[model samples]
Target: MVAVRDYKTALEYVQTFEEKDGLSAEQLMDSSVRGGLTYNDFLILPGKIEYPSSTVTLTTKLTRNITLNAPLVSSPMDTVTESEMAIHMALLGGIGIIHHNCSPEDQAEMVKKVKTYENGFINSPFVIGPNTTVAEARGLKEELGFSGYPVTETGDLSGKLLGLITSRDIQFVEDDTLLVSQLMSKNPVTAKHGITLLEGNEILKETKKGKLLIVDDEGKLISMLSRADLMKNQNYPLASKSATTKQLLCGAAIGTIEADKYRLQLLVEAGLDVVVIDSSQGNSIYQLDMIKHIKENYPKLEIIAGNVVTREQAASLIAAGADALRIGMGSGSICITQEVMACGRPQGTAVYQVSKFANEFGVPTMADGGVQNIGHIVKAIALGASTVMMGGMLAGTTEAPGEYFFRDGQRLKMYRGMGSIDAMKKTDKKANASTSRYFSESDKVLVAQGVSGSVVDKGSIKKFLPYLYNGLQHSCQDIGVISTAILRQEVDNGNVRFEFRTASAQLEGGINNLHSYEKRLHD
Candidate 1:
């Protein structure tokens, strides 16, 4: 007997009455791509899928002798990536990039925090005194790049809080001698340290402030709470952006001989997967010697050297004991090196040219900066990045630094360029100022490229990563491939098709009445 049914009834019969027991789940996979996928894949966010799982190893191979579970890497943008976030990412199976925009000490502290996270014992924060002058507060914010301080009644947390200070309170205050009480918001709202994050958040909402100073039952400051902390706790705004525990390859920058020694020891103890010989120019003898030193000492360590734009510069570093090369000049949103210093390469040509040569040696390369979205990530991977290094794109998410702000019915995170003036003051080795020392150096406060704060809170990478993965998988599925490696092979084999046309062609296909969730349309 032959049976027939309409679309709705057929779907029901397949889901309910169809005989699925004896058949292997694999057989039905292709039959139900729609049902197997989440809404994210269905929407088809843009990205590339270079190879299929059945063909290539998704488990990325590191330079010297390391391996990673995930192919993902976090950007080193100051606003988006930091030590805490880096440690969390490593714990979860990815690497965290430390931005170069900050001072070596502050950046080192960020790295130290990542290291401290491993021991599980942490140095909690303490508040500066209320008597701390506005001039001092300004200096502190400038030096640390964060303003989560409250004024202590007795000059520190042992006493009560007479006022609250934030980056905003002293941002424009001209009276350097003015009492912090005059500058800081008075008797600001706070939360008891013992209170749950939920309870504290409720109190914070009622007060409408950027942070809630956590105190003991006796009202002594214990810790500070910002919207970033709250969201991370709740795994907001995206579960993918949540902090994870992945033992990851982490790299740091060191200029001086002493800094390099300490950095080297830290890398070894941390079981670092890769060490980047960070420099403004990759061809410098300093980097060459440093790379050689690291390889000779930690002969087992993998080294990625250079910020090179050409194969000529890249070759020298590669010959000087570099395992992989970092290619980019100044294509970063916050970087003005190409513009200011007039030395660098256009990112596309740089990747294409350097990757071409590096691939011959079987030594992989990483594309640093110049990535904005999933598509860019795909392109970089296709162009020869074992993995992509992002900076600004990863910033502003929950996993990134800073507190989230709610204003004008929208949520946003603080984002800045590494080369920006504010970042320079906080991380420059020359700053030689403590969080307490440079409480007022505004001339260096050049507020460069990102003053408009052009960043949105995409929740966290915990959620965002899944979105990217599923989206990429769907891209492969649609293109008739099974995994990322296969996609790359196909392109290499000339089986993957490429077409270039005017942008209008994008609208030429697809259903006009495809209807979005929020709106219904009819033909």
Candidate 2:
């Protein structure tokens, strides 16, 4: 029983001098048992909002040299990413890593396809000689999946332009041996090189022709345009492209084996923009040697190394001249590396520690795994990762490299890890055991680090990615930051606070009372 004035003074003093309500990222992490934590184990404390969500910017770096409008990346898993997925990811302001589970030639061709998908001018259009048979033209169409071919006198791109052959020219012709010259449209509409696509499109509309050939001053065919492509004009405003060629930027994955060097040569020739050295444990001597060798030989190429969790592993790769670091180990949803090998750190702790270490050296870091939702992505970035590399999150999209099938009343796409037994057993001769991504040990003993699974179809990435980007923007607004860079700065300065969630708190935070509910990810 104390006096009222004394009690009031004590209450005021306690209120004024109490410890800060929330923990800084470092403090929260240090308090964890052995510094181990996962994404869902903690929550970011909301801050006072000074701006609207729409005004928040999400731009961030993907590598030391490459910047992305959106800080998302698709994983380099065979069942997840390919040319289609890469193209869409780039268009949506992110980048995709093409898997190396196929032959070098096949992978190189995929890279070429992405680079040549859309261009201001077609520098290398298909050409046929005057003597080329109608059947041969049809075969070319079937193989290359294009119906229009420019007819040149010398059957080469440098030859003088003669005519153009289209599917209409051979629709009624039954003779397979008929020469293209006999049926092609002679003196077809032509546009000189250096004409804008708009000008070419106008000329095409006025001529009402299916094909428009762009020729040099000497009348040699240099490029071609199609009315179909113009009508279906797809514009990727956020697309990443080469500064010189204006071709789309693409990345591919490779192992540290000797054959990978030759494969990398082919990929570089195909105009690969970046290479991800695929390995579960990237601190190995083999990976370090490969990183050094590639940096010495291809000095201009950018290399992203690691699937490492600790600061030492990151230091080794960064010292070896890695342009970017991929941080994570055994934290992916489908991963079993920790259980099987009894190694690897929890994803949240790994990302925070490795990114903090790598940022000091001016190298960007990617949160490589354990991104199950948009909240996870926000947490990854808030932890100092420059970008979040997703696997299962992007695996079920329509652009992903797989067909959908129905099972248990749900449409799902196949998703598997590179080290899964099913993936290791794939019959691609070029993808031998040495290139079995996560497992580079003895070929005879199959030690799996992941599993084979399927994910529910999430529709197209066009919708899904926009939802994710908007979610991130809203998150930044809630965090009272106006951009990703600002968020990172605040996090590093300890201005951004966080709190660990107890088991009961997590349960209360989720929708627990509902007996049944239909979940909607986007509004």
Candidate 3:
């Protein structure tokens, strides 16, 4: 019998040029002496495009142990990430870190929600009691954005199975007080709780039902599988999931304080796949001790430590067993850390220096902050970061935590940095995420390192992420690299080129001469 290799393994190694058109990554970093370069300070030189953008692969590692189909991560900000954002981020081939600005129990609940969110099944689905009125069900439908719900004895997953309620039952009910038990479909088909997704799909197809409830031997509800979710599984081919559990990977942020030890324990129990040791400056002893403690206790958990901008900081975290490093300081769009503290390297330079050093220790780095568009993402990869952590770029999306409001006839959502006063004030005083991040919780006075603002509404992650993914693919294709791995290799080999953009060149590259125009990214 003949053996065949997978398509990824069979892919041919593309050629690279010896005589490059512009400065190499190393040269660019070295030449940036007076002040480090930002994304806008330089531009990547395009390579020969030989294949369609759709053919470009973007699989990369977020850490030494965790790999993602896409090199994207949502920042752990109060207004940017929550259970909703984390779930969608994982389903779209990336991960979101749940912010720790809230109570530990609340944060843990958010992590649990992401872990329990199955691709074809709702593990901890919304449930209603038999006595629930038609009006209440309609209100729930509007809140949850779903029409069908499993009806249980006690209105929750812990109760015994009763029946199922759907939009069809309450659509035209004249009486607002009509009970769910009266209109729910009786004797619904269900399977044992431990059935595989394939088996559930088969049962749903055979029974011609829209949902398949999983229950225990005593007829207690365990989960609900939906046909819509099955369709979504087919649609999202690049979803990031764990191989062993077949669940979407989830992450959460935690401070480096003594109290956070308990927070980490709760998060770990909730099936957290990764933990980011969130800090504005990550080189202190607190973070080092926290990293060592976590490594010793939870050997299986991957840790991404830092908001560091130097090689020295990366070395310390890597020594303390960090699997990945977050490289950026004072570079976030809403952050003013450099101005307030007068201590931070330029983002482009910071990413290059730390990522290069971390690579020596077999550690990946996340370029956090200052990512404005798809081009910036490509630039970070070229500079050696394996993934990019987005804050302002991803804020204002439908999934991001916050309600959208109209301002000046434009829809907008709140976006605030963790170090912003508003965010600090919103956090629990005993467990303030902002003060802990800046290592100033014990200070007599509170200081702000970031600002609060709002961003134009950017619709849903379902629509927004695909645009980013395709844009990244097209960018890699233009750079003549078929995969993210090769993109880094080409940059290292000086095959991919870069050039410093003058101020005039920056203006020239944009819509300079256009009188006025509406910029639409995706429909």
Tens digits of per-residue lDDT for model 1 on 151-270? 777776677766687778767877899877777787777765566555766766677776777767777766665664544435422111211222123655444243456555755664
Task: Note the Cα lDDT for every prediction shown.
Answer: 0.59, 0.86, 0.90
Ranking 2 against 3 by lDDT, winner = 3
Q: Could you arrange the candidates by lDDT from highest to lowest? A: 3, 2, 1
**lDDT of predicted model 1:** 0.59
- Per-residue CA lDDT of candidate 2, range 331-358, in tens? 8888898999999999999999999899
What's each prediction's clash count?
A: 39, 0, 0
Q: Tens digit of lDDT per residue, candidate 3, span 1-109?
A: 8776566753242224455568988888884453798999998899889899999888988999999999999999999999999998999999999999988899999
Against the true structure, what is each candidate's TM-score?
Answer: 0.56, 0.87, 0.84
Deviation in Å, model 1, residue 505 alpha carbon: 5.6
Model 3 TM-score is: 0.84
**Residue 406 of model 3, lDDT score:** 91
Off by over 4 Å in 2: 1-21, 31-34, 50-52, 133-143, 163-217, 224-234, 428-436, 439-441
Q: Return the TM-score for candidate 2, rounded to 2 decimals.
A: 0.87
Candidate that beats the other on lDDT, 1 or 3, i.e. the better one:
3
The most accurate candidate by TM-score is 2
Q: After superposition, how far is residue 33 of candidate 2 from its true place, in Å?
A: 6.8
